[model samples]
Target: MAKGKVGKTVGSLGDYLKEQRVGARLSLRQLADQAGVSNPYLSQIERGLRKPSAEVLQQIAKALRISAEQLYIRAGILSPDDGVGGSVELAILSDTGLTERQKQSLLDVYASFLALNAADGADDATPAGAENDAEGTAPITTEIDPDSDNRVTNEG
Candidate 1:
């Protein structure tokens, strides 16, 4: 992978990993041991000082008892939009670490955002003429006078 791509997400990935590790109540050494990596390396990963490989991410995910796909996405190894529609929902649903209630909550929020966007788009979809002629007024007509200097003339 290009350094630029990994650089863009390494900090975010590190932060997420640290949060997950803390939530799991595991020490850095413990996680490193479980993931079969050295303590310093794991620390570097957590501190955003180093970008981990996909294999390392998978191992860490296994150690943390979370979905490898989630780590993959965080690490920029896999795109959240890898599939088609509902990819975000799929990622949330597939995470082994989140409870059913948490997953449902996330799904609800996503649906709400989508609905809001659709509603806003609907408001913008009103016909331009409809708004101008809401009072049942005819549209203005204009014509060019052939006998004059080609000036515009309103035809009532």
Candidate 2:
């Protein structure tokens, strides 16, 4: 491919990967080691000088602890979708370390875990009262269920 085409294709993806890696507090060398890629190669990917294959992106996503589908969408390898994230699961399925039964088992367990969390969130979420406080002023309250296991504490 021409340098221009490759540059355009790699640009956003490289930026996305670099952002995720940085956000995850990983150095380029650390990310390369975890993703099983070379240090210079990862640097090239981050700088929009090289287009990474889907498999490399998957490995990088795994190392970054992100969903592979997100990387796939950023890479233009797959379009955005609203359903359950199957691409990450598909990556797990395709991995050589896991056998067929192991992959199926892992998928089943992961699905169940997601379902349980969704159910828990649905049950715990409640709107704060819209009434004024003892001082005749509306009291600021949280939208999050403090009793729940969510990481965010929403305030209004």
Q: Point to the candidate with the largest lDDT.
A: 1
What's the TM-score of every candidate structure? 0.51, 0.50
On TM-score, the leading prediction is: 1
Q: How accurate is candidate 1 locally (lDDT)?
A: 0.80
- Residue pairs with backbone overlap in model 1: none
Residue 126 displacement (Å), model 2: 50
Q: How high is the CA lDDT of each candidate model?
A: 0.80, 0.75
Regions of candidate 1 where Cα sits further than 4 Å from its true position = 1-5, 84-156
Cα lDDT tens digits, model 1, 46-154, are 8888988656787899999998778877876555764564578667766778876786687768768767877877889775578767876767877778888586846
* lDDT by residue (tens digit), candidate 2, 35-147: 99999999999888887766788799899999877786676545465265566566764688876567657766876776887787698754334334433665555465579
- RMSD, model 1, all Cα superposed? 15.5
What local lDDT does model 1 show for residue 46?
85
